[model samples]
Structures are given as structure tokens and as C-alpha cells.
Target: MTDPFAPLPRPRSDLTEPPDAPQALTGGSGVLQGRMLLQVSPARVGLLRPQLDAGRSGLVLCGPNALQQARRLRREEQFSGPLLVDPAVYEVRAASEEEPFPNACEDTFAFDDPLAVSLAEQRAMGVTAPMTPTGYLHAEDSDALKAAVRRVAALDDPQVVFAAPVDVGWLREEDSVRQLIACLRLLAGPKALMLGGQMDPLARHPRAVDHLRRIVAEVPGAALLRTDLAAFGALAAGASFTAFGAGSRLRHIVAPGEKAKTSKNFSTSPHVLFPELMHFFLGKTLADRFAGADGPVCECASCEGARTLDSFASNAGDRQARAASHNVAVLMQWLRTLTAFAPGLARQRWWHERCRTAVDRYPLLNAQLQQPNGFKVPPQLKRWALAAPASEAALPRADAKDYRSP
Candidate 1:
């Protein structure tokens, strides 16, 4: 039988180059700290119009909203922070397609179509836009890769051309990984850059860490490292600073789990998923858990604290809007923090205590509730975390009010 997970060969190109060392992230950290984080969803923007005008610092436009809000902000001259738009289609194409952009939706679905708002359009809006390259990593043709790089570079703003590194495990082939890294080097040119991707500790073993480190060594600029909030603790068991995305793991909850058995089970519902959790505790938990491992990272306001996570989670109207806005806030806060601390150990001790206690109390969460198979914590990881100095026993109990972390 063919091994489904086998690494495929990379396309031959003169573009191939060895990975560069992790560029020290210094300037942007301070800009991210203590700012209002805003996200664009149809509903959040409508209800939380006040937040947008009230010192909001960062903006994250995902899915279809990326084009709409970006244009709106530009027209109204109301946007503040450097807007980083990660078109939802970018990830969709990367994760769902096997061949180079097999899922490139060529219609007017808005969010799914990359051409709707080209790099050129972003430049016209005076928006500091960044294209999350989903197809570049997997493209086989040299011209296609060059064209992808050119498309992002055309925007004429370094911040606008951001690239998401390898994430989906299904797309983790060596050639694809190498191609994506190479494209970053090319896209980055000389200016500093930042890249982020998912690295689940429970799923990504020591070998995976080594693999990540190998990838880290290749990038030229500050690379944002993201993981499941709890997983971030596991990854940074001893590192100085760790970066988190409100640790919310922003994803579509359109599908139901293996045991879920109702029409409502497969539909989209924010209250049930707690999307706001990503905004509430992702960064602090990461910092506190690893003793400053996430010491200086960029994200929306929830992590930075401009708006209370609880308030965002329980907003009276538009759960998706609140969550999305919170995510934007967190991203901005992260960028500010990175600038302020600029190489300061991104630290957090509070989250550490809570996560530790939660695991001890609710072992079921650590289990793979998301996976089809029954969840089981790997004994090796459990033992490894236990053996460490900031062991579970050293941490404090979780507070009932502190649902933000863990």
C-alpha cells in the first residue's frame, strides 16, 4: 500500500537554497503590546463600531471580510494599525488541494477568490497588506512560483507580503516545505520578515521539534511561531519567548465531531465553540506556561488586554463579530508587545498555573476530543512534562472566573 504521508520530491528550480537562520525579531514587538485588537467579521464590525474608533491598534481581516473591511477602512480613512489580511482562501487552498492550487476557486465567492483584491488594490488603499501565500509552497513551475512572489511583492509594502509557513500536516512533504521556505527567502528579498505556522506538541513529537528548528534556521527574519495555547506550553517547556494566536485556533466549526449526532451538531455556532477563547488567553497562557517563552510576540488585543476576554466572549450581539474583532485586537497587541520588549523574554507565569491545574483536574480536554479516535495523552509527553522543574505540581489551581486560559 502507498504511504499516504510520504514526502514528495520538490520541483527542480534554480531557486532552491538552504534555509536561513531565524532573524531576530526586534522592532515590531513594542508596537503590538497593550493595544486594542480588532477583527473583521460581518456582525462584529456592525455591533462593535465603537471599538473601531476607540484606540483600536491592530486589524485582522480573514475570510471574505478581508477585502470588504480593507476597502471600507481605506475609503473611510478609519483604519489605524498595520492591517494584516490573511485571506481565508489562502489556508483553504493550501490545506485542501493536493496539486498546486487545485482548489483555486475562480468565482466571486469573495473570500475564496484571491484575485478579488489583488496586491495592487491593497497598495491603492494605503493599507499595509500582506498576502498569505498558500499556493507558492506547492507550485511545481518556476514561473508559477516567481509569479506568486511577484504578485505579493507588487504590493510595495514589506508588511503586506507576509507568508504563512508550512502548517497542515497533510501538506508537510519535503519538496513543499523546501519550496515554501525558498519562496519566503525570495519574497523577503532584503527586508526583515515574519512567518507563522501550527506546531502541535501533542501531535508533533521531538522529531517534529527538530524539524521545526531546522525550518526556523532557514528563515531570514523574525518568524512568528504559533501553536495550540496548551500545546504552546508543551512546545516551550523551556524556551524564553513564545508567540500565540489568542491560542483560539481560528477554524470553521461547520462540521461536527465523531460523536455529535444532530443537524445542529454540524452547523456553525459561536456560543458552543467559544471562539472568543482564542482572544482571551492565548498569549498570556503561552508566556506564563513557559516562563516567558512567548516573551515578545504579536497578536490581537485579547492577549494584550485592551478589551476583556469575558466581555468579548459574552457580547450581546454577533458572537462571530466579537470573536473576530477580538482576534484582530490580539494580533495588534502581539505586534506592540514585540516592539516594546524587542527581544525581552515574552513572559507569563499566570497561565502556567491554570493550565497545569486544568490538566490535573480535567484529563479529558487533553484527550483528542477533536479527533475521531478516542483521545489519549501520550505517556512519554506526560512523563516529560512531569519531570520538568515547573512541573504540574508547582502550578496553582484554576480559578472558576479565569476561563480565559487553559
Candidate 2:
């Protein structure tokens, strides 16, 4: 029995490419292979331009006006990277028998037609590599899953990646995940993008986290889109790429018909990523925590010398932009560290060890803050640390040869 997590021998030349190299957008090449993409709303494009221009991967995702946004990014910001316009087809009712959800389809381009038409729409938006138009699949809907598979398998264009936006509930059932994986295996190309609707952080959903690990591990070229910190775990599990949302709204797929909850007193706060903890905290909350005690200090290029992590909480007008930049810098730093290792068991073990150390550090941080329960270790961190590497037998035999980590 082979240890799937063990490092596979590779030529030195194969491992020397810089971590931030641009992904190839052509046939049989994974567009996002081994890359970390920052999904930013149009408003934050200016804040993130330096990083994007420096070759940090980026994704500009919009609804119906994708072309306008992409054009603005290129013309105004001079941004260079892949852009995706979400068809938002998931908002439309997939079937007449489906329960009525609030229809938000008007904001999205009509994708109820066919995959080729959807690709054509994206091409017009200047997307050289487009994703197939897929609807949100409800849990246990085998018919819908099969239909999506057929739609993707019918496409001969290797540049078009299969996209599936599914209810997160599918991750709760092993059989459901297996069925989805089998369907993805049947696609004409190995690359696929997965979006989970209304998915909480993997830390909160232990079952989903485990199942997600399995999905990425078995499916070569699988990428998790519009996700949060959990994207790192998926990358470690063999995902070709992962995208981090710039804001809360972009972090997870909002279920169709769901409205944003609001109140007069509601205010949005910027969240800062604490690389040491591998979790995000509200800027103010982090400021409060480090007020009287020593806390982890970030040394990323953005905050190396003068700025402290707590400075993100300052009432400065540019606070959000600063925080967002700092977050990307820290994340890129982490990515570079991970990619430094050879891409197999070596990288996997390095990540597992990182998670384990983070889990252990929570207690020390709590003690330092004089609050016993102040820092609860994220459950997903513990899971990542303890998860056993998948055995060779657990891999989908058909796509087993395609399972190379980026």
C-alpha cells in the first residue's frame, strides 16, 4: 500500500519555478495550478493593485457587469490577471419542483441556456479561460449532479473549467461527496472549481472539513473558490488552487433568496489575519487583546518594522485598505513558506505541523492574555493536524494519475 502523502521524487528543474509565476491559461494546463488567488470586489482593486501587479494572483469576480469591471480593472488599475464573472445561475430555480427561493437572477447574466453560450458570454467579457455555467445542486439531487456532469463532459474545449456551486450540505454525507467526485471524474478535463453555498468556516463544520479534504485529495486539479482561511487547508490537501475572499460577502456562497440582515446600528469592521494563529480577528478585537500584553507581531513586508498588528484598528480613513494590504502580504508570505517544500508529503507534513503548532499555541496565548477561554483553538486546525493522509486505495482510480500537487 502506497503512502499517498509521501514525497514523490522529481527533477530539480521541476521544483525551481518561483512561487508567484503566472499560471498558463492553455490546453491541459491548470490555470490556477498551485496558486493562491485574492478575490476582490471592484472597490478594493486599488488597494490590492500593488500585490496583483507584483504577480500575486488575483481574481476579479462580478455579477452581470463583469465586462465593465474587467475593463475597469485593466484600463484604470492596469491590473493583469484572470477575471471571472459569476453567472449567478445558482440564484435561479434549477427545477420547477424546487422550493421557491428569492430570485436574484436579474443581477446575474442569464446562464439558464447552455454551457457554450455561457462561455461565449464570458469570452465577450474578455475572459480567455471561462468556467462552465453550473447551477447550485441541492443535497441528494442525483439527477442535477448527473446533468451538470453531462454538461461539462460534452464540452471539448480544454480551456473551459467545470464549475459546480453546491449546497454545503452535500459535504455532510460521504455518499454525496463520492457521487460528486465520480461525476467530476467523468468530465472531459481534470480541472474543476467547487463553490459551497452558505458554508461556514471549516473550523465550525468538522464533517464538511473532512469531506472537503477528501474531495480535494481525490480530484486532481480541483480548486476551492470564494472561500476563507480554510482555503489553505484545501491547498494542503491537494487542491490545485484556492481563492480567498476580500470581504465577508465574498467569503462564502450566499444561498439564493437569502437577504442580508441589517439594522440601523449595524456597522462593518475590518478583519485582520493573524498568521501565527492562522485565523482572522476583528481589528478592534485584536487591538483590545494586545492592549496590555505581548502578542504575535507580523513581519510580513507590509508590517515588518514600524507597524504593529493592532495598528489596523486605528480610526484612520485608510484603515481598511491598510488592513487588506497587510492581510495579503501575510498570506503571500505563508504561501511562499509552503511552496518552499517539495510538493507532496513534504508540503503536506509541513502544513500539518503548522496546524498542530497553532493549536498548541492557543493555550499559551490565552494564558498570556489572562483569559482562559479567550482563545479557543479553531476546530479545523485540530482536524487538519490529526487528519491521516489518505491511502492510495482511497483515491479515485480513474483520476489517480492526475493527482499532482501544484
In the range 195-283, model 1's lDDT, one tens digit per residue, is: 22322322334344333433444645423333334323322232212233321343211111112223222223232212222213332
Best by lDDT: 2
Candidate 2, residues 1-406, lDDT tens digits: the string is 3337634322222212211222323342344567767766666666775655234366747455566777676667665565665555665545212321113444445544455666776777666367765666676677777766655555544466666667777787788889777666554443445454543545445687778878887765677877776667777677777777777666676555676543222244577887778877777777778888755666666776566777766546888787888887777777766666555665666677678788888899888889898767766667887775554223222322321211
Output the number of the TM-score-best candidate.
2
> For each candidate, what TM-score against the reference?
0.49, 0.79
Clashing pairs in 2: none
Q: RMSD, each candidate, Å?
A: 12.7, 9.8
